[model samples]
Target: MNMEDLTWGQFKALLLAHPNLHLQFKYAEDALVDASYHITEIKKAPITSVDCGGVINNWTEIIIQLWEPQGKMGGDAMKVEKALSIINLVEKALTLDAEANVKIEFGNSTFYTRQMYPSAIAVHGNDLIVDLRPDVTRCKAINRGGSCVTADKGEECCTPVKPKVQLIDLAQTNCCEPGSGCC
Candidate 1:
């Protein structure tokens, strides 16, 4: 993970520091979420998978989905306290991992729905803005000195190679047989 990766604990700490400020989200350059946005849901996903390096990986993520009311156009963003209250409510039903990775799920008329990582968090005037960036894909094998790609598409990195066995002269040795006492 990069320095831009935000954890659940860090996010909560940020909100606690500026409880009076309005919370806003910025997905792209100069692009911000509608002021009427709402924190609809908080999801905790536990993921387990095998990577390209044949390594087993496990991790968790906390995804917060934002939705803008279509009828409500221009309004002030919700306060950090309100958002934190929602999180507190969610915690009552589920145990959240503070160290889990954090993601923001959002979409608009022009943008498709996607889970984004928090690239930056800054205080601007009376608002606290969270800058989000699209999540990227990388090969774990390449990071572990194994090739991410193979000459043959059917081949994968770190695939186990089968061992070869040699034939022995069974008749010359006291090998077990169907009706023999050694069997």
Candidate 2:
């Protein structure tokens, strides 16, 4: 998740407030998860990475995977109350970080399998829609005012410069003169 993304606490709070509403997930414009989608699993992952500036960064993410079984068709989405129950069940097994970023894992025949952040949660009629946005690639070093390369901002973060080499004219050397014995 990005710096401005919704956190796990925020997501749960929204669900709590709309317990009576049906939960619907929108991955893209006009692209929504099937009404029969299931909350297959919830994963808590801790990520540690070294950025280009050699800075160690750590974060946690709470990912909820949604799956719709094949041949399953038209039905109303699960109620927010049921989704909360699943969350509660997962909490019994592992402690979830409220501050962790939230992601939704889902895919169908048209959408690719990837984790998306909850950009917005809105009430549309009887449905509580979780609008998901794809996770984007970013340079942590650049975000922290450091450059990945010297050319980026005239500040070298990790890349090193290659030393310039000059060529020598071997034809001008005296080694072929036979030690000055005159070949």
Best by lDDT: 1
TM for candidate 1 is 0.78
lDDT of 2: 0.86
Deviation (Å) of 141 in candidate 2: 1.3
TM-score of 2: 0.83
lDDT tens digits by residue: candidate 1, 137-165:
87776775556654455576656666786
Tell me which residue pairs clash in candidate 1.
Answer: none
Model 2, which residues run further than 4 Å from truth? 1-4, 146-154, 158-183
Cα deviation at 169, candidate 2, in Å, is: 4.1
